[model samples]
Target: MMPPVARAQAQVLPGMGDGEMTASAERQLGDTIARQIFRDNDFLDDPVLVEYIQDIWQKLLAAARLRGELTPELDERFAWTILLGRDRDINAFALPGGYMGVNTGLIAVVGSRDEMATVLGHELSHITQRHISRILSRDARNMPLMVAAMVLGMLAAAKSNSRSGSDVGQAVMMGGQAAAMQNQLNFSRDMEREADRIGFGVMTQAGYAPQGAAAMFEKLQYASRLNDNGSYPYLRSHPLTTERIADMQGRAQLKPGADAAMPLVMDHAMIASRARVLSRPGVDVLRVWVQAAGTTEFAKGSPAQQAGMLYAAALSANELKDYGVARDMAARLRERTAGNAPAARLARLLAAEIELSAGQPARAGALLDAKARDRPEMMLSAQAAIAARNPAPMVGPLRDWVATHPRDATVWRTLGMLYTAQDEPLRAIRADAEANVAILDYVAARDRFKAAQDLMRRPGAGPVDHYEASIIDTRSREVDILVREQHAEEKKAQR
Candidate 1:
C-alpha cells in the first residue's frame, strides 16, 4: 500500500493527451476497467472502507445542491475509494472515472468532517469534468507520431535517469517551444482551481461555512511551507500560490445571501474531537480528550455538534472501562440528537454494556430485547440474552436475524455459542457449521467446529458426534461449491 501522496504521484504517464474519443467507446472502456479493478481489490470490501465512502458520498451529494447540479443520475454515476497506503505522507487523488484514493496519513491529518468534505468535493469536480479521460484520449491519438521525438529527448538524459525531468524536456521539444510539459502540469492546476470553485459552492450549499474550504487550503499551504517541497504531495499536485489565495478571496466575496444557516461551529469542534479520540493510542489518552471536550463550555455551542462530541466522549470512556461516565455521556448525546438512528443505537448498546459490566445480565437482556424489537439487526441483544444464563429466548431472534442476514457469519457463530452454552450440542454443531459454510473462512469456522466437537464429547451427549460430523462434512462441501459458483459468475461476467 502506497501512502496517499505516493499513490497520487504514482502515475504511469507524466500527463495524458488532450485528444478526443468516441463517447460510447470511452464509457465502455472506463466501466470495464472500473469493474475489473473492483473485483480484483479485496480492500474494497473492507467494512471501514465502505463506511468511509458512505460518509463522504452522503456529504458530497448534499454539497452538489450548491452548484445547481443535484441529479439522481449524476449521483448514481459518482464512485469513490479510500486507499490504505503504507506511506505516511498525507495525500489524496481523484481520477476521471471517479476513482478516489485517500491515504491513511491524510485521514490522520483531517481534524473535522468539513475538512474531509472540502477535499472530497474538490477532487469530485475533477471527475465531474472527465479530465483524466480526455487527457488519456489525447495521448492515445498522438503517441504514435510523437514516439520518436520523445525517445530522442529521453536519450539525452538516459544516463541521469531523471524520469520526470526527461519527460518534461521531451514534451517541450516535441510540441514546439510552448513548454508543453509545463502546460500539462498547468492543466492540472486549472482543474484544481475549477474544483476549488465548485467545491466551495457545494460546501456552502450543504450548510457548511464557505470559509472552511479556504481555511483548509490555508492549512495545506502552511504545511507546505513548514516541510520540504516533496514532504507534502497535496501541495505538489494542487499547487497553491499567492494568486490562488486572491482568487479564493474574490470568490468568497460573492455572496448569495446571509440568511443561509451555517452549520454549528460545535460541529467542527466535535468532529475534531472525534478524530483525536480515534487516532489516540491508549484508552487513558482517549478518556482524557473525551472528558476535556465534554465540559459545559464545550457542549454549550451547537446542540448538534455538542451531541457529536458527547458521542465520541462516551465511546472513548467505554473503551477506557469507565462505564458510569460512558453511560452519562451517551445519555446526554441521546438528548441532543433525538431520534437519530445511529445515536439511538449507540445509546442502547452502551446502556446494555453498562448493565452487563455491573453483573446485571438480566437487566441487560431486557434492555437489549426491547431495543432489538426496533433494531432487529442488532446481534448484541442475542449475546446479552445468552449472558443472562438463558439461550431459549435468544434462539427465536437469532433465527430471524440470521434469516434476514444469512451472509453474516458472526451471527451464526454467536448462535452456535449460545446453543452450546445451553447444553444443546447437536444444535450448536449444526449452527456453527452453517456459519463456517456461509463465510468460507477456515480460521473463523475452526472456532465453531472446535466448540461443537467439545460439546459432543460430553458423556451424556448421545449420537451428537455423528450429527456434528455430518454437519461439518456438509458445510465443508458447501464452501467449495460456493467458491466455484463465485468463480463461474466472475468468468461469465468477463465474457
Candidate 2:
C-alpha cells in the first residue's frame, strides 16, 4: 500500500494551478491537509487551550479586517481555524489557507497574552500576505507537489511510533532534491521580514503590547543560544536572524512608553500553566510543580507567579490522581485569582474538572451554571450530565450548537454519547455518522449512515422520530455521494 503522505501528494498534486494558485484552490488544498491532520493522533482539542487561543485569534482576525489586510474574498474562502497539537515543541505554522496550528509548548512558555498574540499575529500575517502561495507560484513545475509532500512528510514524521511514516518522510527530505525540500520548508528571509513587520502592526492594532514582538524575538534568541536539544522546533521553521531581532528592537524603541514593561496578567499565568500541564510533561516535572506550590519561595512570588504555580499544582495533582491535593490547590487558586475574573473562572473550571475526574458528578455539575453557553462550560457540563445519568439538559443546547457548527466532530461525538445514554439508538447512530462526516472521513460516515438506514428498515423498528428519520435519509444520500467522490479521487491518484 502507498504511504499516506504519498497518497496525499497524489490526491492533491494534480490540477494544481500552473502559475498562480487561486484562493479557492488554496482553501481546497488546506481542507484536504486539515482532514489528514484531524485523523492524526497528535491533533487535539483541549477546550481551555482552544478557547484561550481563539480569543487571541479572533482579535487578530478582526484587526486584520479593519486594517484592510484581510480581503473579504480571502477571509470568506480561508478556513481561519487553528488546530492545536499535543507536541511539546515550541512551534506554530500557517498552512496554505488561513489554517494555523499552535503547539501546547508555545502557550506553555509565553508569559502573557501579548506574547501569545505576537506569535499568532506573525502566523496570521503569513496567511494574509499569501506567502505560501507566492512561493509556490514563483515556480509551479515541482513546487506544488514538493511543498505538499514536505508538509505531509513532516506531519507523518511527527506521529509517535510511526516508523514507516518517519521513513517515508526522511526519504523525501533526504532525497536527491534535498536542497529544494529544505528551501520549501522554511520561508525566505524576505518573507520572514515581511511577516514580522506586518505582524507587529496587526498585533499592536489588536491592542496587544508592542513590546511583545521584541520580547518574543528575545525568547527565540535565547532558545537559539541553547545547545540544540529539540525543545524548540519553532526556531527551525522560523529561523530567527540577528537582523530580524534588531529590527523588532528598533521598532519597540520607536513606540511610545517603550520603556514600560508589560506585566504578566493572572489569567495568562493560569492559562500558561494549563498549557504546561496539558503538554504531558512527565510525572517528575509535574511533581516538581506540585511541590513548588507549597514552598516559601512560592509565597514570596508575585500574584501572577503564584497563580500559575497553584494552577499547575492542581492540574498536576489531578494528573497524579491525588484528588485531595488537587482540590486544595484548586480552591487556593480560585481564592488567589478572585480579583481577576478570567483567572477565577479558569480556577472554577479546574475545580469542576477535578470533581468530575474524582467521580463527584454532583459537585462538578454544581460548579458550572447549566445555562453557560461557552464551549468549555457546555462541554464539561455535558460530560457531568452524562455521568450523572441526566443528559437531557445538555442535549438541547448541544443539538443547537451542532446545528450551527456541523464541523465540530468532538461535539457531535459527545451528543451521540448523550443519545446513547438516553437509549435513542437511531439518533445516536446518526450523530455518530455526522461526527465522522465532520472529520471528512466519508468512508466511515457512509458505513454508519448505511447502518442507520438498515436499523430503520428492520422489522418492528419502533416508530422513530419523523424529524430524525428524514434528516438521516438526507445525510445518508449526502455521505454516499461523498464516499463515491472519495473513491473516484483515490482511483484518479492511482492512475
Candidate 3:
C-alpha cells in the first residue's frame, strides 16, 4: 500500500488516460477554434515575428519529444501550430490538439528569449500532457461545442481583460451560469502546478536558461500587485501565487550556476522591439520610438539597446512613411549589430523589409543575401523577385519549401503570387486553395479547389500538366469533404 503522502501526491496529477476524448477529436475541435482565429482581423503572421517565435517553439517541442513526454501518436496527430494575435494584452495560451497562441504584448514585454521560452514550454507541456482532454473528460464530456465556445470565450476575455468572469460566462452562451461555467473554464490548481514542473524541465532541456522561469514569475508577481487593468491579460488566465513564484525560484536554485549570467539580450531586444511596433502601439508611441533613436540617450545606451531602438525606429518610420529615416535607421542597425550574427541577420531583414515597403524591390533583393534560404529570407526574396518581374528563380525554392511545410499559409499565398506572375493561373488557383486549407477555411478552400478543377476540365485552357491536374482533383474532393464536415460541426454546435 502507498503511504498517505505518496497517495495524495499521485492524486494531484490528472489521470494519465485519454478517457472519452480521442486525439483526433481534440484536433478537430482545435481546428474549429483556429478557423475562427484565422478569420479574426487581429490575427497576424509577420514573417520576422513568426520565425523568431517558431525557433523557440520548435526547440521546446524537440525537448519534449526527446524527454519522451510527447508520444509519437500524439505528436503526429496534433497541430502543434502557434498563432500570433496582434492584441496588446500580455497573454499566451494552449488550445486543444497542440495549437498555441502568443499575443504580441507578451513578446514585447519579455526581457529575454529564455523568458519567452519558459512561457511556451509551459503551454507546450499543457498540450503534451493532454490537459485539455483530461479536463473535458471530467467536465465537458462529449459536448465539444460547449467547450469550444468556452475556449473561444476565454480567448475573447483574455484579449480584453476588462471583461469580468461573468462576461466570459455570458460570451460562451452559458447565460446566468457565469460563476459555474467560469470555474469549469480554468485548469485546476494541480494542473497549473504540473505544467510548471514539467515546463521548467522542458525549457532547460531545450537549452534555455533555467533562471528564465524565475524571472518570468517575478514579472507576473509584479503585475499582480498592481491594479487589475486590462494590460496584463496573462494574469487573468494564469493567476500567480507566492507558491508558484517560490516553486520556480527553488527550481532555479537546483540548477546551481546554470545560466548564472544574463543572456546576451541583443536578439531578444530586436525581436521584442519588432513585436512592440507590430502590435500597433498607436501613432503617438511609434513617433516616440522614432524620435528616441536620434536622442543623445540613445547614443549612450548599450549595443543591444541601440539595436532594439534602431530596429523599432526604422520599422516605425516605415509605418509613418518616413522612408528615408527608415532606411537610414536600418542601415545603422545592421552596423550596430554586426558582431552578433542572429541580430545582424534581423537587421538585414529589417533593411530589406523597409526597402520593400518603400517600393525599392531591387534594393530589397540586394540587401538580402543571395545565397540564404531561411523562411523569412525566402519569403521576402520571393516578394522582391515577383515585384522585380524576375519570379522564375524563386518558384523552385518556394515549391520545395511548401512541399515540406504545407500548412504555411503565408508561403502558399506568396507562392500563389509567384505563379500568377509566371502566368500560371491554374497553379495560382491551386496554391490559393491550399492557402485556404492551411487556415482551416474548408469552404473557401473547396471553392478554390473546384475552380482549379473546372479550369483543368476546360479544353485548350493553357498547358495542363497531367500530374498537377491529378493533384488538384484529389485536393478538390478532400476539401469538399472538409467543408461538409465543418458545416455539420457548426450545425451541431448550434443545436
Candidate 4:
C-alpha cells in the first residue's frame, strides 16, 4: 500500500530490451503497467477531471505537431491515458505509447494552468522523441546474458528467501550492461535538453505563457531544496540539472509576441486543489495545507483560488468523516464563486457527497437532480446517485455515458452496480467483465465472463441469456488470447 510516487521507480519493468519493439508493442508495455496501476492504486476516475485533462493534452499535442516537434513515425493513434496518482510527491512520467501519469502532489505544486500545460508538454515530448524506446534498444546482443542473470537472481531469491540476493543479481546484470552499452537504460542529458526545448515551444504554440516552463521548473527547484530528499521521484527519473532550469528560463524570456498573458482556461488552481484533496495525505499534512491554502486565513487570493482552497478543506474533512466541517467549508466555497462556474458546481457536488456519506440520502438526491435551468451538468451526479443508494435517476445518464464512452472502465463498473441494484444480474456480469478488460485484467475478465456463462446454464435459462452467453463466451476466448500473448511476451523477454 505504499504511495504511487514511492512505488513508481521500482515498478518499471526491466530487460524488455529488444529495442526493435514495434509501436504496438510499446503500447502493450504501457497497458501492462496501467493494469498494475488499476489494481494497486486508488485511481481518481472522475469523469470531469479526466476529460478536462484530456482536453489540455490534446491542445498541447496539436501544438507540438504544428511546430514539427512531433512526427508521424511515432504512434499517432497511441491510446493515451492520463492517470491520477494519489501520491503526495511532486512527480509525473510518461509510459511508452503515450500513457502519462501525474501525481496529485505535482498538480498542487504548479501555480497556474500554463504551468500544468508545461508539465504535460514535457511528458508529450518524451513520448514523441521515443527516448524510452531508444534507451531500451541498446545492447541487443547482451540481452540473453542479462535475462539469464535476472533468472539466476530470482532463483537465488527463491532458494534463500532473501530478496537482497535477487537485488544484487539484477544490479550486477544491469550495471555490467549499462557500463558496456553506454548506460542507455537511463535517459541522457541530451534527451532532457531536447524535451525541455520542445516542451517549451509546445506551451508557447498552445497560447500558454512562454515563461510557463521556467516558472514551473523554478517552483520544482525551490521544492527540491525544501524537501532535499535523497530520492525525489521527479529528479530520480527526470534528472533536473541547473543547466536545464536555466535553459528554460532563457527560452521562457523569449516570448512569442504581445499576446503573452497568462492563458485563461478553466480555473486551474481549482483543479490543483481538487487533486490535493484527492491525494488523501494524512490529517497532519492536510492541516498544514489548510493553514497555508485552505479556506480559513486565506483572504489574500482571487475568489477562484480561495474556492479551490475551500474545496480542499471540504474534501479533506469529508475524508476524515467530519460531515459538519465538510458542509461548512463546501458552503463557503459555493458562496465564494459565481453560481454557474465550474468551481461553484464542484463545491455543490462536494457538499452533496458529504451529505450522502452522512447518511442523508434524501438531501443528496436533491442535489443530484437540481432543477435549476442554469445548473451545470457535473460528472459526479452519477456517483452521487450511487452514493444515495438511488439508481433511478442515474440509469439514463449512466447509459448515455457508457454509450459514448464504451471504453471507460470506471463508468462500466458503476453501470454494473446500477444493473445489480435493478436485479439485472446478467447485464451486470457483462458490464463487470468489460470493466476488468478495460484495464487489461484478462484473467479477472475471463472469470467474470465465465460466471455469466454459468448464469445462462440455470434451469430457467431463456433466449436472452443464451444470446448474451454467446457474446460473453467469445469475449472470454478473446481475453484468453490476450493473456496468452502477454505471457508469450514475458517469456520472450526472459529468454
User: Pick by TM-score: which candidate is best?
Assistant: 2
Order of candidate numbers by lDDT, starting with the best: 2, 3, 4, 1
Give candidates' CA RMSD values in order: 11.0, 3.5, 6.3, 5.5
Q: Write the per-residue lDDT of candidate 4 for residues 56-153, one digit (tens) a residue.
A: 88888789878887777554656667887677777778776677887777777677777888889888888887776665455334444444344334
| lDDT tens readout by residue for model 2, 1-495 | 112342234335336556677897677667666777898787889889999999999999999999989999998999899889887888888887777888899999987788899899988988898887776466434544545556555555555365675586675564434345545546789988988999988998999888887788888899898854788877877777889989999987888777788788888988889899998889999999999998999989999999999999999999999999999999999999997888889999999999999999999999998899899999999999999999999999899999898988899999999999999999999999999998889889989988998999999998878888899999999888988877776565444
lDDT of 3 by residue, 108-224 (tens): 999998899999998898889888777666665323434444444545664574887787666656433333544565767788888999999999999988888888887888889
Model 4 residue 288 CA deviation in Å: 5.1
Please give, for residues 78-113, the per-residue lDDT of candidate 1 as tens digits. 443343332335666664334566544565456555
Model 1: colliding residue pairs: 1-86, 2-85, 17-139, 19-138
Worst window of 10 by summed lDDT in candidate 2: 1-10
Q: How many backbone clashes are present in model 2?
A: 0
Clashing pairs in 3: none
lDDT, candidates in the order shown: 0.56, 0.83, 0.82, 0.68
Off by over 4 Å in 2: 1-12, 143-180, 492-495
Candidate 4: the clashing residue pairs are: none
Worst 10 residues of 1 by lDDT: 1-10
Model 4 misplaced regions, further than 4 Å: 1-20, 65-73, 139-184, 224-227, 257-266, 287-296, 369-379, 387-389, 462-470
Strongest candidate by lDDT? 2
Error of 3 at 10 (Å): 28
**Alpha-carbon shift of residue 384 in model 3 (angstroms):** 0.5
- Model 2 TM-score on a 0 to 1 scale: 0.91
lDDT of 1: 0.56
